[model samples]
Target: MIDTDRTAAITAVLDSLADAWARGDGDAYGAHFTEDATYITFVGTRYQGRDDIAGSHNTLFAKFLKDTKLAHEVLDVRFLGADAAVVTTRGDTYKGEHPKKLTKVQTYTFVRQDGHWLVAAFHNTQRKPLMEAISFRFAPETKPKAWPAQLLDSVS
Candidate 1:
């Protein structure tokens, strides 16, 4: 059984990240990650270390991502051990109304460091509905059982 308190703590960290992004506070947003964290963006940009993450986000927030808000829903969380966990979430960045369906799937690897859970690595990938539909239709077994069927229904 998973420890409710630990799960809550980990979820809180994700919440904090979203909160920080909503405020466009790059430093606060990066604080949730470990000092040596690795972050891979949907566009394939790789950021190494918390400083790099914060610096790049500062630039993005000041320009491209200005005024954007992050929306995310946790899909699953699995513990690797007492001090490590992997969390999967669907998310998107929006300016006005929250997205009805998040377009990106993200995975975060979190580690307990100095009694606090911090993201050690993060990977984000944009979902391609058409491609998913084709794959699922051709090979039903390729579909992930945990994924909602609606994820590919739109393409069908």
Candidate 2:
């Protein structure tokens, strides 16, 4: 497949993340990563194991974005080396008549350990979002060539 096609496929994996989280399937959500995956949240929280990630999600699944019928918007996708890539996506967690907006810029490093792209590291943040409405940004001609310097280490 072409790079664009491959990119779309990779993005589909990310889309599933919201699905898993929305359904409150802790095991399914965590299964999307590599065994040694490292995750960093927008609040700078670090989770080393999938257990920690699941535990953390479970704590807020019923309260925040999980109940909000989450949606994602892709901003940019830059490939690093051969098996690494950084993705910037804007998302929203819509709750009861309110959507906790998140301009999530995530760096998803996927490694094809076997034949699937398993997430190695996922670092993301929650940017100030709009109201409960879905904000789909397409043909966005205003992204930076290089990501901001704040993406040095996993903030969490």
C-alpha RMSD by candidate, in order: 1.6, 8.5
The residue-by-residue lDDT of candidate 1 on 99-124, one tens digit each, is 88899989999999999999999999
What would the per-residue lDDT of candidate 2 be over residues 1-156, giving only the tens digit for each residue? 237865876788887887897787767788878888899887898998777777777776755545555677676676765666666666656655534444455667776666676688888776532321122233233333364533222221
Which residue pairs in model 1 clash with each other? none
Q: Which window of ten consecutive residues has the lowest lDDT sum in model 2?
A: 131-140
Worst 10 residues of 1 by lDDT: 147-156
- Candidate 1 achieves a global lDDT of 0.91
TM-score of each: 0.94, 0.69
